[model samples]
Structures are given as structure tokens and as C-alpha cells.
Target: MKNIIKRNPNTMPKPVGEYSHVTVIPRNSELYTFSGQIGNDLEGNIPVSHKEQVENTFKNIERALLSENLRAEHIVKVNIWSVEEINWDHFDNVWHSFFETNPSMTIAYISALGLPEIGIEIEILAAKPSE
Candidate 1:
């Protein structure tokens, strides 16, 4: 079952893109926050295309969560920052393909990043029921 309730109230303007206006996480859940994940692959090579960068970044996030025994389903929130202009089509394509549940996401087009090779960075907030 989903531990968060994501919604866009009718009274408020619909989100400009694929995201909810509000996200509500249940009480007593264990929250895990990850640092910004970049698109660097195992060989430390980052692809030049924003699409590839976005794809690899999500893959890295999966690998990171798995290291802690968590899967994509455990993620409650998604946040992304891009050095280039936001490409909704390509971004949503990769994002929807990766995550079955549309967790609330915050994405922005930023002017710069930590590394010149890194075109995109993503951070995620995951949760699990407290034992």
C-alpha cells in the first residue's frame, strides 16, 4: 500500500506538469533521504545528452536504494534539478517508465551543477513502515 497521499486540489491551479500540488506522508514511518544522484556510470563516464543523463540518474537512485534494502515502491518523493532547460517529454518518459507509482516530484531547470559533466541531479525521499 502507498504510505503517502498525493493530490492537487481542485481549487488550486493544476500543476504545470506531471506532479501533485501536495504530498502527505503517514505518521510513524521511517524516512530515508538520499543525496543528489548524478548520471555518472560505474566507469565514471557521464553521457552528454540530457535524456541519457536523466535515465542514468534514476538508475543510480535504484542502485542506491537497493543497497539499503529498499525498492522504488518505497520512495515517497522525487526531486530533480537540471542544468539545461527542463524537457518535460523526455523527463516524464524516463520517470514514468521507472516509477510505477507517480510519487510527488519537484523538478527545476537550474543554471549550474556540481560537475560540468553532470547535466542532471536527482534526490529522493523514501519511507518504510516502522517495525
Candidate 2:
């Protein structure tokens, strides 16, 4: 965790969201890239409420990281896209539930997503030393 530095540089504008201005990854680290994960269940049913959707998405991300033997703390960056507006508090809660350290994040409200029923989708990058 010490190898990954979260920077809020004095020269750059202060972050308006719950994230660092930049994330610095050290050399020789093995990076894991995850595709955007939605809130759909195995049955193809999506959560109805925004909060539920966000929660499910978080679970999906956690499962993906687990497959690679990585936890949220190893994540260096994250990008969240939503079809509608989201409550910052809820987002913060989800982040806290997953990550011990806050990784660099970018959240965007968009007109549409990959799925019509999905309210939120998340993608992340994680790193570990190459063995």
C-alpha cells in the first residue's frame, strides 16, 4: 500500500469529489484491469433502487478482485458511471465497505449505460508485484 501514493497536488485544483487528484503507481507492479461491472444478478435481474444497484455493483467488483487474489486495498484507480444522479453518501459508503485506502476515483453521470436497467457500473485497476 505504501507503494501507491494518492496525490492532491497543491498546484492542481482541489478535488471536488471523494477522490485524489492523482494516483502514482510504482514500476514493476502487476496491474489488473477489470471490465465495467453492472448490477445484474445471475438471473439477469437488475436491482430496482439506485442504492441496491450500487450495492450489487460493489459486490460484483469485489468478486472480480477476489478471482485475481486482490482485494480493494490493492486498487489504484476506479471509474464509476451512472445513468442517473447518485447520492454521494451512498457512494462513499460503498467505497468505504470495499477499500481500506481510498483510491483515485472518477464518477460520471451519463445519459445511458451498457444496460438499460443498470443504474451504475464500475471499473477498476489494481496492482501487485510480479512474481
Candidate 3:
């Protein structure tokens, strides 16, 4: 198994979930950075609801991670963008369901997305520890 280390300082707000605010892996490990994913379904249609969009965006990230033999737990940093601000409680429910254990996250509220219905966008940085 790969060893991991948390790097958040005690002065910072405690993580609201099961993740540390930051993590460090061995220097030799392979790393992957994924682009921001929107809610577009496989058929090229964006979902209409925030929940649907968030779920699809996460699923897309999962697929990308799987292609590299990684999972959500391997993710180290996540940057999220939402139209207007997030509905925190609603977002928390969906987020915990997908991530199970949270990862380091940063969220921003943007004025708009190219598609008006797109309420959220997410990008991720992940690393797999070396054997």
C-alpha cells in the first residue's frame, strides 16, 4: 500500500469531513491533472439541475481518473466553480456521496458558464504513490 501524509496546519479550520486540507505523496509518484468538467451528458446535452450537473461532472472526473488507474481517493486537490454561490447543504450531500472522504477543495462562484444551465464545474489534481 502507498503511504500518504496530511499537511494542513492546526491553525487552519478543521476539515469539515474525512479529508485533510492537503496531502503529500512520495516525490516519485505519478501525478495527474484533470481539466474542469461541465455537466454535459454523453449525448452532448447539459443537465438542467444543479444536482444532476454536479453528479455528471463528478462521474466524468471518475472516468478520467479510472483511465489512469486511480480513484477519487487518489485525488489531492479539487477546484470547483459554480454559477452564483453553492447551496452548501445540497452540495455537501452530493459531494460526500461521491468523494466519501473529502479531498482538499477550493470553490469559487462565477458569473456564468457557456451554457446557462451549467451550475457547477470542477477540476482535479491527483497523484498515485509510487510502489
- CA lDDT scores, all candidates in order: 0.83, 0.84, 0.80
Question: Sorted on TM-score, highest at the top, how do the candidates line up?
Answer: 2, 1, 3
Candidate closer to the true structure by TM-score (higher is better), 1 or 3: 1
Candidate 2 residue runs with Cα over 4 Å from true position: none
Model 3 / residue 74 / CA error / Å: 0.6
lDDT of 3 by residue, 15-92 (tens): 765456877776788888888898778897897777788878888888889899998878888888999666677777
Q: Give per-residue lDDT, candidate 2, residue 28.
A: 86
- Segments of candidate 3 deviating more than 4 angstroms: 15-19
Question: Which 10-residue span in candidate 1 carries the lowest summed lDDT?
Answer: 1-10
Q: Model 2's lDDT to the true fold?
A: 0.84
For 40-91, candidate 1 gives per-residue lDDT tens digits of 8889899998888888898999999999998887787888888888577887
List candidate 1 stretches off by more than 4 Å.
none
